[model samples]
Target: MKTNHPGPLVGILSARKADGSIAGNGPLFIALQKKLISLDGKSFVFIPEDAGIDHIMGYTFLPEQNHWKKEKFRYPDIVYNRVPFRKSEQSEQCQQFFTILNEKNIPYFNPCFIDKFELYELFKRHSFLKTFLPETILIEGKKDLFLFQKEHKSIYLKPTQSSKGKGILRLRLTDAAELQLDGIHQHELFKSFDHFWEKYGVELLTKNYLAQVEIKSAKYKGNRFDFRILAHGEDKGYTVTGVGIRQSQTQDITTHIPSGGRLLPYEILQTNEHDNFIEAIVPEIGMALSDRYGYFGEFSIDAGVSMTGHHYIYEVNSKPMRFDEEEIEEKKMEQLCRIFLQLSDYEN
Candidate 1:
């Protein structure tokens, strides 16, 4: 289990061969490398340096037809596990590299512990969260989707491993010929299950998708309000750093920032009386998760509220977006750095 990499190092693993967030989306991954470089100690980023690495060594692997043919690295201190991730498909190369890390016992910021569906399994166990969680069924085709929709009327289709509203669709019925989707509006209204199966059969077949009955989300401007709860692992526990609401702008079903949503102050999330309700509830949920989900202290849980005033957890992110100041603040970065050090010691 020994190699030549130095102690307390950070390796930002990339799951994807090419990503749009090579710079903007990889702050913590980049910050860990920068912190290493500033120290008079040996440090290097293991990806492409121009990908916004300030002081760390950057490494790269050549790709041929979406395959990592050749890779170069001297080894790393700790890995941030910042791999570009696609939930539905696992690349053989990514699987191999992950195996290598596992065999090596390298510390990872967010260890490969859980996936989206497993998180749902965890969510269903929460007494308070279970009711708000829509009746969900993993479906292979429109028959399954149609059965759920026939009863629920409105259903949300999500990829097994998705982020930022990509491949998320809300289906509704109308008297027309195609199905009406969330962001796309009332464009297609599927008249029969066969029609839907013919159009989106491949997506339903190959992709691991789940269908959940839609919740009438807590509304702001008749759209929806969702809380992006940011928490981090520290000695005290998984602490709720901040809770911001992502209110969908217009013509969007989700409140994800990349999908035409804007962040609002926490207070804007509730009325004067309900603000205290929110404050009280968030801490309780945070405490429960910290106790149960061993090692995952830092994350963001996307929560939605229904018209009936119930809060539903949409998704929980193990490796969340770093704060705007994480790059500049040394003390906070040090705390996060410590978490990486502790979690990386997986063998212990």
Candidate 2:
């Protein structure tokens, strides 16, 4: 939709409370708004409830005055979606907005939710990327678990669409041949594999999971850690804007910072060679995904380094959470501006 705003109007779409205020990640929304203004661009926050075919009522942050100003705005030129939860993003209004934006040709970042199982299949098709991926298989039922257990001492059964290390089951076979199931909250030990199967039973078969051989990752302060490479797309190509290390806070499966994890410098895990290798591959992965599923403005790729220095990709986040570092945060803002300006330039 056309707008009379002096600068290109960008919209930060998010989930809101009953009062029409953005509910989650308030700092991120505010940082993005101020950053856009710094680049002589304007943006506002809009929720699904405020969105309509022709216009949307949104809230703009005035950094100078340090407050939000409400206004009725035309459909923005570009929408930076940060709706945290998948269910909220999949709501009827959000789904309808996606269709409307596509019909109007309004560009958006991370246009859709991508499943982990599908992503694994995509990565498997590329021979060159095989070394960077751990052995992974889609778990259909009990059979898949039994087969995976036969080969690996430890394996992780993760939901296809899960976050924050939630609902992940880590199965380990000890020297005594005992089966142990470890999760965020629950931990159980069984004398036999059959006994473990009988305990979990049909509950395991109902959910979609990926059976992946657990990597012996590099550890810092006794906790396993991984690197998060934040990459953003520009007119030229995809660029690695920032990198950081996430160390697991507990003995859990994932090192997601939100799950009691701590942020570390990217240098702690990577050498110059490792950085170069990752930087070279980041754009390739971005392009490969884009070729398969259209354009994406950004992605957070989680990669793990083994004790022997071998690196492997663990996950690809379409909509990533904000990093705690100020430098990384600033870089993210810069990338956001690049995405908005580049798309706006093309459309005009």
Candidate 3:
């Protein structure tokens, strides 16, 4: 049954700077806190470094007084993780903090960071989801790369655990077997496969990466484009909060907006058929992932629509990016708060 309370207390978790100020998207946190209150929920920023077994040093913003304040919040009903970097998320303090929460039986949404290769394998296990995923393989060594290149003339090498299009590479083979690599800032050419691997093979083999067959992604004005759809989940199901198209400014391997890409309205970049397909699949992927991951609040799925109308889900981000507009961001925050309250109600 639902609790007879004014609101549920939601905690926004993130790393803090040495000075004890919140790091990673401070403005977004502030906006979310304000929006949470408006939705009849309370929020505070929980810095993992300052958290103890008893309580955490929570930061609260006071819009009326035009200043910030700190308080000792014993704990929140739910935790919304916004920890930006994987390094920080894997830190000793952060791990311990989460362990403490788990021990206390406190629930968290979007529990942990999802790895690219791990997510791909999870989807591959289910036939329904496998249809939407591209042919992806783990890049263990040069042999795997050779097999992939022989089958697909063009491929993408992406870091298994990365975001914002960092360390992504696009490689293509010419009719003469010449290899070319296109990076975010520059491009390089190799005389042959042997030469290409000899120079960069060791570096790649040492790191975790995924080699995927390149999708014939839909394009606008010669630039590749894809949909970035955000979905929020509840006990009943999931809802698509927002849908927008991201077009690459350059011919890069990824279309992440922060990687020099621009956002466009869905209608401008998609046809009615494409829009309908996305609308149907967005919730399917959301619910499927939520069921698999156990409990998740929101997911930002990057899906590509081929010119021929075949839809492919590029990836699912647990911690998705927020839109620039205040209204849209606020709406997302509201959805998050509502989901927390729904879950709290059920648990209570």
Candidate 4:
């Protein structure tokens, strides 16, 4: 299987494992490599430290060998920032690698991890999108938290820099005058707001957090569900690749699969009006994000239909995780390959 556009190599910037393989989702990388090969393009995964003046020490997949081959290659036509963790992406070496990409004029999309608070602010600026956003405030102190909780009664405190539902706290003010706190592990009842803040304030205040009003998401069979819509750039705009549903297993604070959420059939949403809502807003979101954040080849939206039947946008992830659904995953791979070839202008 030979590719005519072999020169337009795509580089996936990621962390290296202890054993020297590319970190992040292993199956996703392998699938991406195979997809690019089928498209008559090429891709490799490299760490920041592997980059050099004129070449990069990276790993390319060999179909016959059934292994990733370590080799030196010329700078790729474009780089895809897939650095899995925020800590790794923010490292000095990663910063230096991005500088080299800029200096050499190589293109890339999804530059870095977007702060949750900053993304909310960006979306708030657009009048049409503003209505869909939950009332959000940057939690700076007990005062901010208290006021937000008072206004919404039920609010979610989330770390601005974290993902996969990590570091999330849900606070609800019950009619009994008790403040209830729900997290990944424990649920506690605080006698008052001050009491809750006294215990959790230091941790929340010291780190960046955002307080958002809970949407009371519509549920199915007693489990709250949300839509994960993946979109990719095409013809100077973005189009929907697929939509997936994640339902809460324990009615946890988030619908993230890692946080005790389970996948549901997409058919559940296909019969509802929410499907139309997702289709309408996804392209708008992609355009707004790209306009403000620069070229975004791909992104995924975490959205829900409120109990009142209104659509609300919760979060937009720059680096989307692999979809468990086979159809969505296939569409994602096809779109990824097309986006890579289009961005690199690979002639095949």
Candidate 5:
């Protein structure tokens, strides 16, 4: 791979609120840019444009009004392309620029275009992903639910396009997982199908739905503990960067940080009994996804292990979270930035 003497031009693509505050993914966006800047004196430069299409490379403005231009124009020798996870409100008009960069042959993190269903299907069809993937049934309508229930006892209903684990619920004939109905949270149990549907029927009516067969996760304090394993890849394979466990508040069904859950380091989880298992298994989980799905670099893999010593890969991220644990330092960020510049040369 050719070396980018000075790093490539870079850009941060993110949504800012109507009041002009950076939106959800903005902090990490800026952090990456700063890291690139520090790594190569003036090598990486973030193109300033609409949130619609962002490339961490060279860009020139078309002289449009309200541009609020922050810097001079530069063409991208390479692009970082940390585009937002979801096409967002601020990015609604910024779509075409990403394509422009791709057409011009600037190597971006992920290709400019991806069918949203493409990765999901790859994950589902791959043999390795089968174990950790709960029985996922595409819910077309009410009939899909009926057919699934006939074959399985419990299924989790989740939105395909939702993030931060939103609009997710567990459906089963049990008193275990409780939720709110009419704004009331209770330990309500469902005795039969009729009883279950009566409460959540309206939510099911919404169009896009995904049903996953339920699997028992390792529980702590009656809640669940799952690892968000962060990784980055090159042509070689997916490499485990760090593994952090998410512990939910007592009795909470989901283990999302924003949903009253907290992140725990690996030390808290191993506790002697599982040391050998962690040493043996955690490093290898990402290999399956990379081998099957062709994921190149920078992924956050969500995985889990039960107290019974079973390991499963729940999901893979093409774009991972900002894993800046305290142990991770400025020098490491520089290393990652340097690596990205190198990846661009090889990919190009």
Candidate 6:
């Protein structure tokens, strides 16, 4: 890849595998590197522990060799945080690396993961956006869970720091006055609140969990469905990159693919009303997040339309995973490259 006018040097901060290759989605990174190269730009993947003040040990894809090659590079003009896990991002080494980037005045977006409880609180402060959020409360004791259940009848308990529909449980009050609990792997019923708390709710007090009202999402052919909207920041504000639909296979508690959900054709749910609704909300959500959490290059929103025809925002991921849809993935790569160039002030 050769060009007379090359773009800026961008560094992707991520984890390293045992073999020292960059960890996470290799295909996504390879594709991104190729896209940057097409624009005559240079990019590399580096771990926080390997980053230095002057030069960092990093890996760049060698198309000729068809593999990643390790090398040393100067601090990038801009950095994109893609650290694979929450624990790794919280390490001392990662903190120190960011300090170095700050000292050198290098720009970076999405510094860390966003906590679900904190995000809910942030949305509550925004009057317009708050209405779209489900009523959420941090679970501290059995009393909190009981009160929430009594109010909503059915609620979802979610780990604040988890993703891919992990550690989420749905609890509903049956007409028989029993508690019905449904998890990804387990389903059971309790005769009384005490029984439920003794078995499950007691453990939630020890961890960070949020109790949220469950949205009765609209369904397609008896399967609950939702939309994943990818957005990227631009000079003016944020723009929607692409939208993909995920439908639950067995009408499960979540529409996440890992939790037995399947991706459907984008055209299946496309409509003028849906398009207009998304257009009205994406900019507001993006700007609100930026104001509260600093600039974010890109983020993905998990949202659904209720059976009552109202839209609800379920989750926002700062570090988004790879979209399965080909068109969505392609658009994401292109938009991300554009954001990198704009942030680095690269003249393409």
Clashing pairs in 3: none
For residues 53-131, what per-residue lDDT tens digits would candidate 5 score against the true structure?
3323332222234122354434455545454445542253445565576577655553222322344575566555444
Across 1-348, the per-residue lDDT of candidate 1 in tens digits comes to 333444444556553345433322444444555555454222233433322212333542222232222334454555555444543125565555556655776544554434556667666887765654667887866667777888887788887776767788888776664567654343565667677777777886577788877888878867777877666666655555666778888655777777777777766555654454445545555555555653454566777777887666677776575543332234546656666556544222
Q: How displaced is residue 114 in candidate 4, in Å?
A: 1.2
Score residue 157 of candidate 1 by CA lDDT.
82
Candidate 4 is scored at a TM of 0.94
Candidate 1 TM-score, C-alpha based: 0.72
Each model's lDDT comes to: 0.59, 0.82, 0.79, 0.86, 0.54, 0.87
Summarize candidate 3's per-residue lDDT along 1-348 as a digit string, tens digits. 436556777888987666855687777777767776776677788778778777888888777785668899877888888887788888888888888888988888776778898889888887777888889998898888888988999999888988778889988997776898988886999998899889888767777888999998778889989888878875667777878888888655678777788878876865687767767776677776777765778888888888777889888888887775455576787787777777666334
User: Clash number for model 5?
Assistant: 14
**Whole-model alpha-carbon lDDT for candidate 4:** 0.86
lDDT of 6: 0.87
Off by over 4 Å in 3: 1-5, 17-21, 325-327, 346-348
lDDT of 2 at 260: 72
Top-lDDT structure, candidate number = 6
Residue 269, candidate 3: C-alpha displacement in angstroms: 3.2
- Model 5, CA-based lDDT: 0.54
For candidate 4, the 10 contiguous residues with the lowest summed lDDT are 1-10
- Cα RMSD (angstroms) for every candidate in the order listed: 7.3, 2.5, 2.4, 2.3, 6.1, 2.3
Ranking by lDDT: 6, 4, 2, 3, 1, 5
- As for candidate 4, its clashing pairs are none
Per-model TM-score, in order, reads 0.72, 0.92, 0.92, 0.94, 0.73, 0.95
Collision count for each candidate, in order: 24, 0, 0, 0, 14, 1
The per-residue C-alpha lDDT of model 3 at residue 8 equals: 76
Query: Best by TM-score, which number?
Result: 6
Regarding lDDT, does 2 or 5 come out ahead? 2
Q: Which segments of candidate 1 are over 4 A away from where they belong?
A: 1-7, 15-30, 35-43, 47-75, 87-89, 99-104, 113-115, 125-132, 175-179, 184-186, 270-297, 322-335, 341-348
